[model samples]
Target: METTDFSQPIRQSAKGIIVIFAFNLVTFVKKFFVLFIAFGVSILRSKSIGNVTPTMMVLAVIGVLLIILIIAILKYLNFKFYLSKDDFHLATGIINKDNTIIPKSKIQNVYIKQNFLQQIINVVSVKIETAGDKKSEIEISALDKPTALLLKKKLFRKASSVSEELEQSESIEEPEVFFKVTPKRLLLEGLSQNHFKSFLLIFTFGFGLYSEFKDFLQELELEKHVEGLVELDEATILNLIITNVIILIGVVLISFLFSVVKTFIINFNLEVVEHQKTIEINKGLFNKVSLSLTPSRIQNLVITTNRVKQYFGLHTIAVKQAMVNVKQQKNFNIVALEKEQLDYLVNKLLSNYNDEQGDVAKPRPYFMRISALEMFLFGVVINGLSLAIFGIEMLWINAVFMPLAALYVYFAYKKAYYRISEDFVTIGSGVIDTTTNILEIHKIQSVKLKQTIFQRPRAIASLVISTASKSVTIPYISKSEAISIYNLLLYKVESQDRDWM
Candidate 1:
């Protein structure tokens, strides 16, 4: 088990201070330019005469620039950051001083970044993100590399100390190994997925290229002077078809090459390493990327297997965790793993489930039927009349509402086909793109039970579980089933101390 001490203050080096000042100075100049130009434009447009005197405009611009410069200087002076035994403090604001404190325990993630300019200056940017508020994250930009590293270590120690103080049962042991795609595995999986998607991509690319370049190709006028006597009557049309096909082929080949190159480059130099309580992945080619995640931070787990992978007895699984302020959910993927490996991974992560747990789930039998009265009223009274008013030529297509009406019945049947256990809910649906969404009880945030008159007679209801990006919906389930799941989710959310997303 790993242990850390939290009672330490953060400090920056002399180089860090200079680099920060330089960065702020550049930012200040840029802001000044924008403000000065905006003021100048306003003054010019609001002049008494159609054209304002150049002298007044120049002086006005200078005055605005001077104010901006002064503000920038004051802002730089006002900004300050300090770390204490159990919290971090930041204060800023030129005219009105503002101070904010973030407890060590509240820090969700600390971001470290460096750009080309920052590298030259031997500085890095550190952003402290929290789970409490969306816009309240604090940033300490352009600090010396050593200072940034020190800050990161300090935060890590603080978090570790807190975990220890909380007396959590789980010992903070270092991970055995960070899982990464081996070169052979990467090649195999990349090629497999590439081949699977290639046909669709080729067709789409070829068609789009033809559509875009048709006029240009035709405008070349080379076809008119063709010497070949392939066809006399339908020569022009044949030539057009041939030209389009050639362009399509070229486009497909080029797209395929591009995909291959991109895949290789992206998966190049991939590395994964785990320290106590944290898994870090560093990868990418030109624009290197790094992702750090902790198991306690996980919000949801998603495992997906494409038809090809399934056919080949392989599976790809991803574990997702919520990251504050980050647009994308942070995910770790295990690609092309065999059934045994996948099972081992899953068992390790969710140790609460037994081997026979998945099979023990039973399908809820309450059936919900869509209200016939509501459907009839909507079809004839609402949609039917609207189409008539709009002068739809093929009104019979609308008049025959079996296709849409059939959906109601099938969805109900599909919902009946699935089952839910105490620990997890499994929803199975879709015909061509068959999918099963398995959500753990602990991952559910808020449960919403929705029903309309259209659904009352059908006895069908929809349950939406609030997640990080979008709510997961289990639709056309029996009212009983919906309520059962809803209650279960509610109990889990209330009982668990972890925040949902």
Candidate 2:
């Protein structure tokens, strides 16, 4: 394998034209979906004035594809990148020329990925991220695997000699596998994952879609199909219960399917590989992604699990790194790790990391009172909405939620604790699921004391600890305790000679 000189500008493989054209076509289709749906509806609404031939529709789509293909070709022609002494320069733009230069030292990460389309075309995508940008600043979508690897190395200046580069390119050794997830484990993880979000998403999408097509359905007299649903209003209590149970089961099953399919697809054949200086991830089915992580660059480690998962000895750990923007923060989740595997990974990431839940300090009982009040107000809002929207008959819905709220408040107050140690600060929290966030004291970016007017009356304050990854809040604690924690964090951070990044 011959390595290309970095000094020379390089263009993406010609196949980039196809990928770019496909992307634009997809975007155009998504944007004009309503128009397409309306056109279909108009055709379906009447059959007499339907001289709109199928040939015309096919030609219209072809015309759109041709236009997008031309644009993609022009865009591909203008895209080229090269490496300078201490910077990576990219020149791109179709209508107006644009140039971007990124300092090599500022390069945060370089990831190589291949989607289904790219895999078919036998090209990989190389994305270069930096400290200032929320997303990758440079993306080359059509590069051979070797070229992508070479470019990644050059961005990080990993190879010092041409011989080493050529040797690396020619004979690459596979990294040792740290962990490999089995399909059964994936299925269990999918089952154990919290599906509340998925349920809400499916429910919301279904409602919105129904609303969108309600008028069309009415025009087609399709309401007659579901008119049987109204009979439930006049049913016996037992029948109502049975019907409700059936609906609940169907929703839960749908949500579980969505979650399971998503989990399997995203983590298909997942493998964590250990490299000399970094840990790498290789996963995804249709879209293959490979990411490298330097342990020293990690900001925090979060371990999350729930009672259901605990029964099966399963835990999920999130690896968080320093990033300027929260939205752009690169957090990797490795699910379904056993206790021993979790310990091994944690110790490897944080040298000598202790799992001792040292003398923990619980938040003041004022926190409990606060939670109760919030839940009470939430109940009132729910009942009020039920009354306003569905009449007084649906107010019983609040009763069903009251017990859940009480349970949440109980566990929330019970789980809230903070432990400050010589090297780490652990924040324990969550309701049904338990989340343990451990951050090295030296990685603390800043500490803040926040107090609300209500909290001031109780002499309680919150400690907001900010790290490069995200902020953690320990709320409803005594003002004095908050100050002590704040001072200890600052002292530890100031005394450290090591950099967080």
Q: Candidates' TM-scores?
A: 0.63, 0.85
Candidate 2 at 171: error in angstroms?
A: 9.6
> Which segments of candidate 2 are over 4 A away from where they belong?
1-4, 32-64, 157-174, 204-241, 324-331, 389-399
Residue pairs with clashing backbones, model 2: none
Candidate 2, residues 1-501: lDDT per residue as tens digits? Answer: 988777888788899998898888889999999999888677667632357665677787788888999999999999999999788899999879989888877777787888899999999998877756464557788888998888886776632223566557434766689999999999999998899999999888867897899899676655643664665654555675897798778888999999999989888888888865567877888988877776766788899999999988889988887763553242277888899999988888888778674668999998889899999998889889888878989977867898899898999999899888778888999987899999888888889999999888889999999988878988888999899888878887887776877
Q: Model-by-model lDDT, in order?
A: 0.60, 0.82
Worst 10 contiguous positions by lDDT, candidate 1: 1-10
How well does candidate 1 score on lDDT at residue 491? 80
TM accuracy, model 1: 0.63
